[model samples]
Structure formats: C-alpha cells, structure tokens
Target: MKSLQDYTTVIRPDNNGIFAAYIPLLSGCHAWGQTPDEARAELIYVFEMIQEEYKEEGRSLPEDVELVIANAS
Candidate 1:
C-alpha cells in the first residue's frame, strides 16, 4: 500500500551525463537514466521490484526515515 512517493530518493547527475537515483532505505537498489525524470522512473521500477521480492521472501519492507540537511558552517 506504499506509494513510490512514500520513499525518499536521492538523485544526482553522474560524470557521464547520466542521472542516478537510489533509495537509502532499500539496500542495493539503484537506477540510472539519461535525465532526472527518467532516473526517477527507473527508481520507481526498482522499488516495486524490491518490494515484490521482499513480499515473496516473507520479509517486512523497510520504513521510510526522515532526511534533514544542515550546513556545517
């Protein structure tokens, strides 16, 4: 019942001009695309795939954690 938006995704542009995305909550889950939107789409697919795997394995899905950023200086 968890939507893709429920999870936090970190998207960044790689040096190769490709966009990369990953969910910190889910280990070993990642995706890459030509653009940010594409990267996000791929990440959604990855999320769904991992969720299904967890369900099949009778494992509980990880809960989302709040992320906060602060300046060091």
Candidate 2:
C-alpha cells in the first residue's frame, strides 16, 4: 500500500460545495472536505482505514483507480 504522504491525490469541488478527495491508487476509498486542506487530510485517514480493512481480510486492494472529474449526467 502506498503511504498517504507519498501517494498522489486529486481534489475536486462537488455539487454540494464540499470537495471530494481521492487517491490515484485506491478504488472506492475516498473522503470529502469543505476545504482543500480538509480534503487532503481526510484522504490520509481514509487510506489508513482502507489499509486496515485489507490487512484484516487478507485481500489485495485495487490500485491505479482513476478519478473522473466530469459528470456524465
């Protein structure tokens, strides 16, 4: 698993004014923030939680999940 401090993060504004933050490495594990700083910080915590889940289940986590910035709708 990539460290939270080392992995690439993408930040985007969402419909509700909160920002969504995602890791370039993990799929389905993300965080939301009202500000950019919170978004980044939240991602770190989300990453750790995902890591713990993976470790406990003895399963591999999906990586390289790309974030789509545009809404298809």
Candidate 3:
C-alpha cells in the first residue's frame, strides 16, 4: 500500500519567485505559494482533497510512485 508520503515531491522556485510544489505522479496535484513551506502545506491540503475524491470514486492511487533522490556530479 502506498501513502501520500510515498510519492515524490518536487519543489522549485518559478520565474516569478513563487515556490511551487507538486507530486509529479499525481496529475493536477500541485500548488504555489510565496515560500517553499507554504507551497508544501497547500499541496498537502490538495493531496487530501484528491485522496478523498479517489475514495469516493472507488479509485486507488498508483502503486508505482515512490520518492527518489539523485545527485548530479
């Protein structure tokens, strides 16, 4: 079973200087804020909403999504 924490989260500052956070595996699951923490907090709310919707529709999140860290040499 996969939980929300199991998904990979990508956060970066956009050209406008707003912080954006999202789970790439979940389509339409993204949020933006003035800071990284704010963006992530909003994203968590969005995730909960999406999760509820999935539950209502009898759908389960994909099992293959996982967090990965890579280093650039």
- Best-performing candidate as measured by TM-score: 1
Q: Flag the better candidate by lDDT, 1 or 3.
A: 1
Error of 1 at 73 (Å): 5.4
Give Cα distance to truth, residue 13, candidate 3, Å. Answer: 0.4
User: Candidate 2: where is the Cα deviation over 4 Å?
Assistant: 60-73
Rank candidates, TM-score, best first. 1, 3, 2
Residues 22-68 of candidate 1 have per-residue lDDT tens digits of: 98888978999999999999998988999899889989787899978
CA lDDT of each prediction against the hidden true structure: 0.89, 0.80, 0.87
Candidate 1 regions exceeding 4 Å error are 70-73
TM-score of 3: 0.82
lDDT comparing candidate 2 with the true structure:
0.80
State residue 42's C-alpha deviation in candidate 2, in Å: 1.3
Clashes of each: 0, 0, 0
lDDT of 3: 0.87
By lDDT, the better pick of 2 and 3 is 3
Estimated TM-score per prediction? 0.86, 0.68, 0.82
Q: What CA root-mean-square deviation does each model show from the true structure?
A: 1.4, 3.6, 2.7
> Candidate 2 on 43-72: residue-level lDDT in tens?
888888988989899986654544467878
Q: Write the per-residue lDDT of candidate 3 for residues 9-72, one digit (tens) a residue.
A: 8899999989999998899999999999999999999988888889889999876455677899
List residue ranges in candidate 3 displaced over 4 A.
66-73
Selected candidate, larger TM-score, 1 vs 3: 1
